[model samples]
Each structure stands twice: as structure tokens, then as C-alpha cells.
Target: MSFASDNQSGASPAVLNALMQEFSRNGTSYGTDEATKRAEDKLRDVFDCDLVAYFVTSGTAANCLALSALGDPWGAVLCHHQAHLLRDESTAPEFLTNGMRLVPVAPFAARLDADAVAAQIAAMPDDRPHNIRPQVLSLAQSSENGQVYTPVEVRALCRVAHDAGLRVHMDGARFANAVAHLGCHPADISVRAGVDVLCLGATKNGAVAAEAVIFFDRTLAREFPERMKRSGHLLSKGRFLGTQFSAWLHDDHWLDLARHANEKAQALATALTSINGVRIAMPPEANEVFAVLPRQVCAQLGAAGIGFAEWYGDAILPDKIELEREILVRFVTSFASNETGVAAVTLAGGVLSR
Candidate 1:
């Protein structure tokens, strides 16, 4: 009955089964096992390119370590103000980069365009010795506001960043959802779009905890192993992380799970908007639905044990929408989400509205 977050959901059956199978076996440690190799190979096959893929236990570790490699100590990484790296990661990027600054760029709907990035870079002081030089542009696929960046948009942003001598990194914690929403291949929106590195996340999708830091430009990944070790992110039982991803990617299981979650979110958004005094704050682009409901209705939903969260960020609200007595809420669906839970929430809202 919880719509609070995909993170609250349990691992998918496929992922759990893989973990169980791997737990019974003895394998080499520290990413030297066959399972770890298979997982990296799976990522290469999916991306359709030769890449350096390193597995880690969390999105924060993947992003921080990857950004550490992309940015220098005196450089700046440009990203949307509401990006997870900026708002949620608790300064891990700065700490991992040994004081590389994170420059916030304002972009509508959490999608950063080339112009916005270029302007941010231009605004920095010309005196390189006194001001941090912008060196990386970080984009969030299926952004914090749940808006997916199209391939063309990504390519344009990357071109701008590259022209300004900045590398591009994508925080792809919801990569599967974005690909499912776009109906495009992963490479189309990432590697081919000039993303230098991508933190491919699986924890929110289905795995217990698994994220991959993939470098499209292999040269950028050369130092990642040392970084992982130094940062205490290198797992001794690395096969645990590898097995989950290996199962998640096999037979396109990841996409199927993401599509199911996205469809459920669409259905939930439609139901929410149908209720009087309830309206969507932003488009339901991935597995997240952002809506504004009358305060009384929100209270009713809470009383009925329908779990959701009060959302506060840079979501673009509908014009002329009044929010004096309303609450902006977020509902997240996952591979384990069911129609019963969605229907229950909608039924509660409908009952309360009457």
C-alpha cells in the first residue's frame, strides 16, 4: 500500500533468486569472479560499445567516484540545482573530488539545456587562478522532476559542454525508466549522445543494491579502481552485486520491470487528475507521479494508510494553480507495485472529494 518511493519496495523475484543462487557458491573475491566479469560484459553488450564498467553498492558511491575521475580538485561540475548529486548526496561529490565544486544551473523541469550550461560557464570569472574552472556537466536522465531528456536534447547539451572543454556525466539512477519512456536504446541517449560517463543504477529498479559506473571513454576510467579502493567502496563479495545486475540485464528484465512501473505511474496520474481539486504538477515521465491535492484529501489519503510523500523541489507547476491549501505529493511505483495499491489510493481520494 506504499507509494512513498521505489526505494521502499523489495527486490524483484528475479533479482532475489539470482542472489540466492550466488550465495550458495564459492567464487573469487573483489570483482575477480566470473559473475563480475559477466556483469561487465552484459553492460558492454547493452551499450554496444567497449566501455569500462565498475560495480559498486550504491548510486552515491558510483556518482561520487565517477565524478572524482571527471573533475579536478579546482574544477566545477555543472548540474541542475535539484540534481541528486547536489541536493541529496550530502556533499559526497565534493568530498570525493577532494574539493571540486558543484555549480548549480537552473533548468526548467530539471532538464539542463546547452544554453543554460554554456551561460553558467560563461558567468564564471575569467580569472582562472581565483575562480573554479567548469570541467564537467552532469545531467540526470529521468531528472529529479521525473522528466526524461530526449536523445537530441542530451546530444545538444553534451556538445555545448564539450565545446566549453567540459566532460559530460549522466546520473542515470533511473536509466531503465528513461529508456522505457523514450522507446529508445540506452546508447542512443547516453554513449552515442556523447556522455563521457554514466552511473547506471539498479537499486531503485529492482536490485537490493547495485550500481555501475560506466565510462564510455575508457581512458577516463583508468583510475576508477584506485578511487574505489581508496574510497572504501570496493566490496569483497563483489559477486553479490554482479549477480543481481547479471540477472536484471538478462533477457531485458530490467526494461520490462521499468515499463511496468512507468505504466502504473501513468495510470496513477490519470486517476489522481480525475478527482476534483487534484491536478498534476508535472508530467509523469518515468515511475514517479507528482500531483497537487487539496490538503483535506491528502490528510484523508494518509489516514487511509496510503503512503505517499510531500514533494518539494524545482518541479514546474501548472500556471494559475493555487496551492495555498493544497499539498504537492509524489507517488512512486516499482517492479513490485500493483494495480490494487494504485486503485486503493484513487478510491480513497475519490471518497474524500465527495
Candidate 2:
């Protein structure tokens, strides 16, 4: 059983089949192919709006391109301190934005707190280039901690960001899972919630590796195609990227995959709560469950060939968990997670059986 990451899973059967079908069809290159067109149409249908979208192979490229499209080089992108764009992307956002600063703001309830963001935006010294004006406000759906943001929460942050002349960007790395959990239309928390651009991810849900940089405010995408081409994200035979999304989104297969993962995570969280030495840290709003596991249980799970991500830091973790003897672990369930796997891990712990 592996909970290392959602990326550990293989592509969904539908996505694989779509790719196989595309193998025989000869199409134009660089997102001009039939598969590419099909994927774009699927997104428009999913979000229920006309928009511009570009397919890429990684979320990094999607975020970088989408953010760069909204801000100038001297501007700043405000995002949660623990956001993937801030901590995990390894300067890609900076390099692509040409040194556009990713200013970290405190996140409350697993999202960019509207008050904190507004205060930061106002606190900036905007006296004629003395300091960079914050131009973008970025928040992650199914946040890094695996908590989902509600539509009302999204609307508040968006309103605050927009009032201060800031464009909103959502790092939807687990977009499908968030929507599946919220039981809301994709547009309800995104475009309709005032997000200017979205880095919609499919790879972590069920695709092999495909992401979309979607501009709900189509005007922000004016120079994005040229930027994407220069950044090497514009795949030559882009049909491969397109085929993944085309099949993953068809018939709402993406939501189906996400629901399975979220169910497994919720079940695991419930089981872990009964264990003697485990404490549900973040209480999982999506497919990721963060819990404090006793050091002995950690060893037991590892010995049984079960793997997990040992998350560091006590930023959001409470004082109830003893950091000295317990480790903060992230248990991530994906489309591939099954009941058998969850049982083996939850029951395998010697510490739990006590």
C-alpha cells in the first residue's frame, strides 16, 4: 500500500484508451491537433463558459504561465505561505515571472485569508515603484494541507483581491477532488467566484501527466501562447497531452476518480481516529489525511511495505501531538486506492492493535 503521493498511481483506463486511439490519428502539432481541440471543448463544457486554455505536462508550467500572464515583472503574487507555488515549485515561478515576487501571506482555514491578503495589499508602499505592487492573489484548492476551500470562502478572497486591483489565480492541483468533496460545479468555486485564471490539474487525479492553464478572463491570455511556446511547455505533438484530459473529463470520469480517492481518505481518517496513538492533525478535507503517528507505528507501517510522506513542521498542527515521539505523516489516497490497501495500513499498525 502506497500513500506517498497521488502521482504514484497509473493513468485511468479511459485515459490510456484515449491515448491508444490517438496513436493512429495523424494530427497537426503544438496544440493544433484534433485531440487538443477536443480537450479545450471539454474544459469549456465542464466550467460552463467560453475561455482560453493551454495544455501542459506539469502544474509548474501551468502556474508559471498563468501567473505571468496576469502580472508584470515588477509585481508580486500573494499566496499562502505553505502553498505549492511558494514552497514546492523551486523558483520556477520566480524565473518565469522574471523575478515577480511570490509574497507569502498567512492562510487561515487552509486558504488565503481575505483580511490578511487585503492588509498586505494595503501595507505595500505603492509610491511610484518604491515597492512592487501586489498584482496577483493565488490560492490552492484542496490546499497543501488537503483541506478544501468553500465557494463562499473563495468569493470573499476573490472580492478582496479584485477590489485591490489584483488578479486571482487558483492552483487547482487537486481540482477534481476539491469539487468532488464540495459537491459544487467547477465554475462555482473558480470562474464564477472571480478567479481570473486557473491552473487546472488532471495529472494528480487520473491523467498520466497533463495540466491546463485556463484563462477565464480571456483577455489575460493575450500573450500567454507566446510565453508558453518560449517556456518549452508547448509540446510539439501536443495530442498526447490533450488525449489524457479528453478522456479523463469525458462523462465526468475525473469526478468519479476523485470521489473514490476522497472516500478512501475519509475512511482511513475515521479508522485512524480509533487507533491508540494516532491523532488526525488536519482532518482531511480531500484525499489527503495528515495525522500524527507514533514513532513505533511509523516503523511498523514501513516494515509492512506501506509507504507514506513524513510531513515536517508544526505550522498548522496542534500542541496536542507530541513531536518528540510522534511524526507528522501525510496519507494520500488516489483513484487507485482500494479498501484492501486502507485496511492493511490501518490494521497493520502494532501500536493500533494495542
Candidate 3:
């Protein structure tokens, strides 16, 4: 009944098998091996673009490097105030970009609308000599709030950023789930929608430590290899990542894993909606469900050994009267989630009501 995080899950069987197969053979190092080439080719086919793809160990590296490719030391990358770059990555983006700044935008949803994005860019004076030039816009698909953006929404955001003379980057930490939830081809949400770069996430889905930095505009990533190599992210045992990603992309393995996870989340959301005193914080999209559980409900779940994180907020009511306080538990279902696990969580929540 653990709704803590998808990261808590293990690698899928198929991904593990692929890694074992690679272990049986010797390969070149630093992304020059056969496995690496196959992974890159598979990503090009998946995104349906002649994009430059590089595999990295973690999502943070993918994001920082992708942004670094779009900016110089004095440039700025704009993203949602709660974006991983701003709130979670511990300043790696700034460091990787050689002191490039991350400017936070407002309107407060995990997802940023086109107008809010435009307003922030327009507010930054273009003529200031000392100001960090606005160079990139990074958005999270299936945003931090667990909301998924449709194809049109992604394109609209892209159009705004491009018009502002900024390249767009997507922190696709949940790329597989977003693709599966939208039931659209990967290209529709990325290259075709004007995204210049994307961090194609795999760790949070099913792979062990596989993540890819996909540059849809090849011209924008000319110096990325140097950036990656210099950062110590260029894995000498690179085929390990490649082996996992290849298995993830082959025969829609990634999508299949994502679909299963999303299905579990959807079922959990449906069950929660039926429970009294529990509020749905965000509609279920992809594999994450955010909820506002009553105080007693939260305590009950906690007592029962179900794990989750409190969603960020003041956690205090405006008035002297203490309201429910709205605990935001992040319920993440992975490909490994089974019917029994889902049902167990549902029953636990039901205990709060009784």
C-alpha cells in the first residue's frame, strides 16, 4: 500500500533482462558502443525526428545539460516556480550552465499557461546589459501537480517561447506516462510541437538508471558532448544505460509500462473520489494521484503503514479555526503495481471513513 513514489519501485523484468544480455558481451566505452548507437537510433524513431540524443545517468544531468546547451554562463533559463530546476535539482542547472540563472515564473499551477509564460519573458527587459539574457524555457510534462498537458497545450506553450526568441525545453521526467496517458505518439508532444530539447525520463518509469537528453534541434546541441564529458556524467560503462533504454523503446516496452502504471493510478483515483472527507487535489493523469486527505484520514493511513509525502503548502488555515489542512499525499503507481496493492490502499482509506 505504498503510495510514496515510483522511485521506490524496482526495474522492470524486461529492462533487467536486457541488461543481463549486455553483461554477456564486451563493449566500447563513453557512449561509443553498439548499445549506445542502438538507443540513439531508437529515440530518433520514437520522436520521429533526426534529433541528437545522449543518454545520461540521472534526470538532473539530462535537464541541466539540455539547458546548458541552450544558454551561456550569463544566460537565464525560465521555468515554473515549482519546477524541478528551481525547487528540486539543488542548483545543478545553474552550475551546469556555468552560472546561468533560473528565473521563476508565476501563476502557481504545476503547469504553466502560454500567457503566463509570455508575461514573464516580456517582463524581463531585453536591453539590460547586466541582466541574464532569457535563453530557454523549461516545462514539466505531466507537471509536478500530476496534471498532463495535451498536444495542443504543449504546442501553444512552445509557440510563446519561440516567439520570445527563447528555445523551449521539456523536463520530461514522466515522459512515458504522459505519452501513454495522452495516447498520442511521442513526436506529437515533443519535436512536432516545437520543443527544442527534452529530457526523456526512464528511471521513474521502469529502467534502473536510464535517462536521455534529446535535442530535437540538432543545431542547438553542438557543444553538448563537451559539456557532458566535462561534467563527469559521461559514463565509461555507458552501455549499461543504453541497454536499458533500448529495452525500454523496443516494441513499445516503455509505453506498455507507463500504461499499466497509469491504469493503477486511475483506479486508485476513482476509489478515492468515492470516499467521503477526502478531496481530490488534482485529477489523475498519468501514474500519479494527488489528494487532499482529512487530518484523521491521513493519520489513519500513516498508522496503517502506507507511505506518502505531504504536498507543499502553508499547512495552516487562514482563520484561527483549523480546517482539514489538506494533506497532499503523492500516490505513485508503477508498472509493478498489482491489483492487490491497489485494493489494499483503497481499503486503508476506507478505514478512515469508518
Candidate 4:
């Protein structure tokens, strides 16, 4: 049983088949391929907007490129301290934005409220020569701690960011999962919610290695192709990237995959909740569940060969070795995470109790 990460899961059959089909026909190279254009059109249709969606190789590229569109070298991108751009990407946002600084705002879990972002921008000394001007506010949809910001929350943050003369960028790496959990229209958390740019993720959902950089403001994406090229994220066989997104978006397959993953996570959460000494750490809003498990139970589960992460957190009761001290563990369910895998972990928990 593997609860490692959604990225560890294999691609969906649909996406694989689409990739094969693209390989079958002779197509143009780069992003001018027919499949690439089709996928771009599909994204515009899906989002119900005229903005162009550029296919990229990974979510990092999408986010970095999107940020590049919003920032100048002297500008700063404000994001939650725990955001992927801040921690995971290892300063790719900075590299892509041409040496722009990333000024992390408050919220340890990367869930930023609108006012906090605005307050920071307001506090910045714009007249200072050395001070980096705040240009964009990047918020992760389903934040680092597996908590999702509601559509209303997104709107509020966007409003605040824009009013402070900053564009809004959504790190939508887990966006499909968030939308599935909330049961809202995609636009509700995107353009309608005032997002200037969205990094539409596909790799984690079901695609092999694909992500899209969608700019709601067409003007911002004008020079993005150059930025993507310079960052080495522009794939030579661009149709491969397009094919996956095409299959993912076709007939709402992306939503289907994400919803299945979220449902499995819910099932896992329910099972964990029923076990003694197993407490949920911040209820899951997406496919990720954070649970607190007893040391014995954790050892028991690990011994049984279930794969998961012991997330980083301060030990509340370090000396209580045998007691049920809180240990935050991240359990991520993916499209391929079947009932058998879920049962394996939950049943192991039961066995540990016995």
C-alpha cells in the first residue's frame, strides 16, 4: 500500500492512450503541433475564457513561468512561507522571474488570508531603492498542510492582492482535487475568484508529466514562451505534453480522476477516525490526509509495509515514548489507490490495536 504521493502514481490509461495516438500521427515539433493547439483550445473552453493556456513539462514550470509573467527583476512575489514555490522548487520562481525576490508572507501552512498579503504590501517601502516592490501574491489552492481555501476565501485574497497593485497567482498543483472536494465550478476558484494566472496541474491528477500555465490576462502571457524557453522547461516534443492534457481534459476525465482520489482519501479518513489513538490533524480538504498516530500504531503500520510520510512537526510530548503522542503523518491517495491499498493500511491499524 502506497500513500507516498500523487506524483508516484502512474498515469491514467486514457492519458497514455492519448499519448500513443499522438505518436502514431506525424505532427509538428515544439508547441505548434495540432495536438498542442487542440489542448490549448480545450483549456480555453474548459475555463470558459479567451486566455491562452501553454503546455509545460511540470507544475514547477507552470508556476515559475506564470510568476515570470507577473514579475520584473526588481519585483517581489509574496507567497505563504510554506508554499511549494518557497520550499519545494528551490528558488525556481526566483530563477524564472529573472532574479525577482520571493517575500514569504505569514501562515506557516501556506494558507494566506487576503488582509495579511495586503498588509505586507502596504508596509513595504515602495520608495526605497533597495526594497523589492511586491508584484504578485501566490496562493496555493489546497495549501501545503492539505487544507483547502474555499472559493470565498480565494475571492477575498484576490481582491486584496489586486487592490494592493499585485496580481494573483494560484499554485493549483492540487487544484483538481480541491475542486472535486468542494464540488464547485472551476471558474469559481479561478477567474471568477479574481485569479490573474492559474497553474493548472495535470501530473498529480493522472498525467505522466504535464502541466499548463493559464493566463487569465492575455497581456501577461505575451512573452511567457521566451521565459519558458530560457528556463529550459519548453519540451521539444511538445505534443507529448499536449496529448496528456488533452486526454485529461477530454469529457472531464481530470475531474473524474481527482474525485476518485478524493473519495478514497475520505474513506481512508473515515477508517482512521474510527481507530483509537488515531486523530486527524486538520481535516483533509483534498486527496491529502494528515493524521496523528500513536508510536506503536505508526510502527505497526510501517512494519506492515504501508508507504507514507512522517511529516515534519514539533513533538508535543517528546518524552512520552509509549503514549499516544501526536505525530503528523501525511497520507496521499491517488487515482490508482484502490480499496485494497486503503484496506491494507486501515486493517493494519486495527491489527495494531488488537
Candidate 5:
């Protein structure tokens, strides 16, 4: 059983078929092809709003360029301390924004705490020439900690950001899963809730390498095309990226893929909770399950060839984890997860642990 990451999974059959069709045809370069237009139109229908969509190959490129569009080079983008931009992106934001600061705010379960967000913004005012102005607030839906933020929570954070004259951005690597888990309309947590831009991701769900930077507030996307083109992210063979997204969104395939993954995650969580001494790190809201596994249990799983990640971030409270004997671990389920296979593994472990 492999629960290492969704990135480890291959492209779904439907996405692959769509790509193969595009491979046989000749198309215009630089995102001017029919596939790119279709993908953008479908995305606008998904959100039920008029939006500017730019297809990019990677979420990192989508995030950095979108942030670069919203914030000035001398300004700052605020995000959770555990956010991908602040921790995982490796200074791409700094490079793309041309020296803008990535300020990490205190995190609540790997999410931005609106109160802390307000306080942090208050500390840096435009009136102070020496202080870096906060120009953007980026939130990771289905946060790095594997917790999903609800629409109400998103609206509150967005309200705080907008009140401070800062545009809000969402790192939506798991956006599909978040929507599936919440059973809410895609617009509820995005444009309707005041998000300025979203980095819509599909590669982590089922596509090969498809990501879209959607501008819900078109004003924020004024210079984004140049930013994307200059960064070498605007693919010349762009239809491949476009076709993947087009297929991913059609027939509600993206939601189906996400729902299956989420179902498997919940199944894994339920199975693990029955094991003696094993604790659910947080109630999983999406496709990721975090657990505090006893040391014996960890060794046993490893010996059995089950793969997972050892988590050490502040996503879970230290007091809740028994450092002396228990280890914090993350198990990520994907569209490729076989429910019966994973269930068998966890069920056997539960019996053995008891």
C-alpha cells in the first residue's frame, strides 16, 4: 500500500485519452489554440463568472506569476508559515516578484488565522516608508496540514485581507478535493468569497501537468501574461496542458476523481482509528490523513512495505503527539488508490496492533 503522495500517481485514463487526441492534431502555439480556449470557457462555466484563465504547466509557476501580478516588487505577500509559498517554493516568489518579501504569518492548523493575519498586516502600514507593505494574502485550501477551510472561514479571511487593501490569493493545489469534501459550489469559496486569484491545480488530482491561474478579479491580472511569458512558463506546445484541463473538467471528472480519493482517505482514517494507541492527528477533511502512530506500528507498516511520510511540521500540536513513542505521519490518497487494497492493509494493522 502506497500513501506517499498524490504526485506519485499517474495520469487518469480519461486525461490520458484527451492528451492522445491532441497529440494527433496540429494546433497553434502559445495558448492560442482551440483546446486552450475551450478549457478557459469551461472553467468560467465552472465558476459561473467571467474570469481570465492562464494555463501553466506547474502550480509553482501559477502561484509565483499570479502573486507577481497582484503585488508590487517592493511589497510583500503574506501566507501561513507552513504555506507552500513561504516554505516549499524555494524563493521563486522572491525571484518572480523581483525582491518582494514572503512574510509568514502564524498558522492555525497550517491555515492563516484571520486574527493573526490582521495583526500581522497592522504591523506593516503603507504610512511607514521603512516597513514593507503587505499587498497580498495567500491561503492554501486543504492546507498543508491536510485541513480544509470552509466557505465561511475563507470569507472571513478574505474580508480581513481586502479591508487592509491587500488582494487575496488561494494556492489551490487541492482545490478539487476541497470542493468535493465540502460539497459546496466552486464559487462559494473562491470568487463569491472574495478571492482575487486562484491557482487551480489538476496534476495532483488526475492530470499529467495541468494548472490554471484564474483571475476572479480581472484587475489583478493586468500584467500576468507578460509575467508568465517572461518566466518561460507559457508553453509553446500549450494544447497538452489545455487538453488535460479540458478533460479534467468535463463530465465532472475532476470532482469524481477527488471524491474517490477523499472516500479512500476517510476509509483509511476510520480503519486507523480502530488500531490501539494510534491517533488521528486531525479529522481529515479531504484526501490526506495525518496520524500519530505508535513506534511499533510504524516499524511494522514499514516492514510490510506500506509507504507514508513522517510529518514534523507544526500542523499538529506537539502536546498531542507522544514524541517518546509515537510518530506523526501523513498518508495521502489519490485517484489511483484501491480502496480494498488500502483497507486490507490498515485492517490487518489494526488487528495486529490490538
Candidate 6:
């Protein structure tokens, strides 16, 4: 019944079963195990391309290690102002890159516009001696405000970054949701869109704790293993991570789980729209629903033990919009969410409105 976050939902049954099966088997330590190889193969097949995949325990490690590889200590990684890497990671990216700065750019609907990115880059100081050069452009696939970026948009941004001598990285913590919503191959929007590196997340959608830092550009990833090891992100018993990915990617289960979450989010968003004094703050993309609710309704939902969070960084709202007696909140649906939970929240909102 929790609409707090997709991570609040536990691992998918398939992933958990795979973990149990791998627990009893003997395999090599580190990432050299056969299971790890199989997981890499599965990912290659899923992406429809040959690329390098490194499994890590958390999205933070994956993103930090990937960015560290793409940028130098004196470089900057440009991204949306509301991105998790900029707002939530707590300087891990800077720490991993030894001093790389995260430069916030123009954020529209929580997505970075290519023109805006170009303008931001163009406005940076050209004094290489004293200014940090923009090295990497990091885009969140399903942005923090629950908005998804289309393939064309991603390609345009990548082109802008690459033409400016900046490598592109995608913080794909909710990549499956974006892919499922787009109904396109994962490679089409990311690898083929000229993304140099991708932090593919599995923990939020269905896995217990598995995240992959995928390198579409081989050159950018040549020394990533060293970076991962130095950052202590290399798990000794790596088969556990492999097993989870193997099961999650098997038969396209990852997309199915994401599709379910996305569908639930849509349902919740639709329900909220029918309530008076409630307004959807952003497009209900992926598994997150952002909405502005009356203060009384928010208090009622909170008192009823319904799980959600107060979202403060909504970029979609106009500056002139009145917020005197209302607040923006985010409701996240996961593979485990169902009609019952969604209905409960909406029904409460309706009752509270009366």
C-alpha cells in the first residue's frame, strides 16, 4: 500500500529466487564468475549491441564511477539542476572524480534542453587555466520530476554535447520505465543516441541491489574497472549481483515490471485528476506521479498512513502559480502496486474533499 517510492517495494520474486539459487552454488570470487559473464551476455542481448557492463550494488556507485571515468578532476559534468546526481548523491561524483564539478543547466520539465545546454556551455569561462572545462553531459532518462525524454531529444542533446567535445552520460536510474513507456529498444534511445556511458539501475525497479554501469563507447570505459575498484564498488561476491540481473533480464522481465509500475502510476495520476483542488504537477511518466494537492488533502493522506513525499523541486510549475494553501507531492508506484492501493489514495482524497 506504500506509494513512497519504487525502492520501497522489495525485489521481484524472480530476482530473489535467482539470488537463492546462486547462494548455494560455488563460483569464482569477484566478477570473473561464470554467472557474471552470463549476466553481461544477457545485457548485451537486451541492448541489442556489444558493450561492456559492470555490476555494482547501488546507483550512486555506478553513476560516480561512470562519471569519474568520463571526466577529469578539473572537468565539469553538466546536468539538470534537479537531477539526483546533483541534488542527492552528496558529492560522491565530485569525490570519485577527485574534484570534478557538477554544473547545473537549464531544466525544462526536469529534462535538459539541447539548446539550453549549448547556451550553458557557451557561457562558461573560456580560461582553461582557471576554469573547469565541461567534460561530460549527464542526462537523467526518466527525469526527477517523473518526465521521460524521447530518443530524438536524447540524440539532439548528445550531439550538442559531443560537438562541444563533451562526452554524454545518462543517469538511467529509471531507464526501464522510460524504455517501457517509449516502446523502443533500450539501445535506440541510449547507445544509438550517442550516450557514452549509462548507469543502468535495477534496484529501484525490481532487484534487491544491482546496478550496471554500461559503456557504449569502449574508449570511455577502458579504465573504468580501475576506477570502480579504487572506489570500492567492486563487490567481492559479484555473482549475487549477476544472478539478480540475469533473472531480471530473462524473458524481458525487467520491461514487464517497469510497464506494470508505469501503468499503476498512470492510474494513480488519473485518479488524482478527478479529485477537486488537485492538479497534476508533471506528466505521469515512468513510475512517479507528481501532483499539487490541497493542504487539507495532504494532511488527510498523511494521517491515513499513505506513503508519499513532499516534492519541492518541481520545475514544471510556473513561477506565478499560487501555492498559498497547497503543496507538491510525489507518489511512486512499483511492480507491487495495484488498483487497491491507488484506489485507496484517490478515495481518501475524494472523501477528504467532501
**Which candidate number has the best lDDT?**
1
Q: Please give, for residues 1-354, the per-residue lDDT of candidate 5 as tens digits.
A: 789899999999999999999999999998899999999999999999999899998889999998888888889988887787887899899998898898888544456778999988887666657778999999998788887889999999999999989999999999999999999999999999999999999999999998999998788788777887898887899989989999999989999999999999988888877778778877899999998989888888888778899886456453566678989899999999986758766666766676
Task: Give every collision pair in model 3.
Answer: none
For candidate 6, list the clashing residue pairs, or say none: none
In order, how many clashes per candidate? 0, 0, 0, 0, 0, 0
Q: In the order shown, what is each candidate's alpha-carbon RMSD?
A: 1.3, 1.5, 2.4, 2.7, 1.6, 1.4
TM-score of 3: 0.95
- Model 6: runs farther than 4 Å from truth? 107-109, 318-321
lDDT for 138 (candidate 6) = 93
Question: By summed lDDT, which 10 consecutive residues of candidate 3 come out lowest?
Answer: 314-323
User: Considering TM-score, which of the candidate structures 3 and 5 is the better prediction for this target?
Assistant: 5
Regions of candidate 5 where Cα sits further than 4 Å from its true position: 107-110, 125-127
Candidate 2, residue 68: the lDDT equals: 86
lDDT of 1 by residue, 1-354 (tens): 889989998898999999999999999998999999999999999999999899999999999899999978999999987788998999899899999898888554456878888888888887858878999999998888788999999999999999999999999999999999999999999999999999999999999999999999988988788899999999999999999999999999999999999999998988787678888887898999988888888887789998988887345666444567877888999988998998987787678668
- Candidate 1 has a TM-score of 0.97
**Candidate 3 steric clashes:** 0
Each model's lDDT comes to 0.90, 0.88, 0.85, 0.84, 0.88, 0.88
Query: 1 or 6, which is superior by lDDT?
Result: 1
What's the TM-score of each model vs. the native? 0.97, 0.96, 0.95, 0.94, 0.96, 0.97
Superposed by TM-score, candidate 4 places the C-alpha of residue 15 at a distance from the truth, in angstroms, of 0.7
How would you encode candidate 2's per-residue C-alpha lDDT over 33-63 as one tens digit per residue?
A: 8888989999999999999899999999999
Which portions of model 4 show Cα errors greater than 4 Å?
A: 107-110, 314-324
**Residue 150 in model 6: lDDT:** 92
Which stretches in model 1 have alpha-carbon errors above 4 Å? 107-109
Residue-level lDDT tens digits of model 6 in 137-156: 99998988787889999999
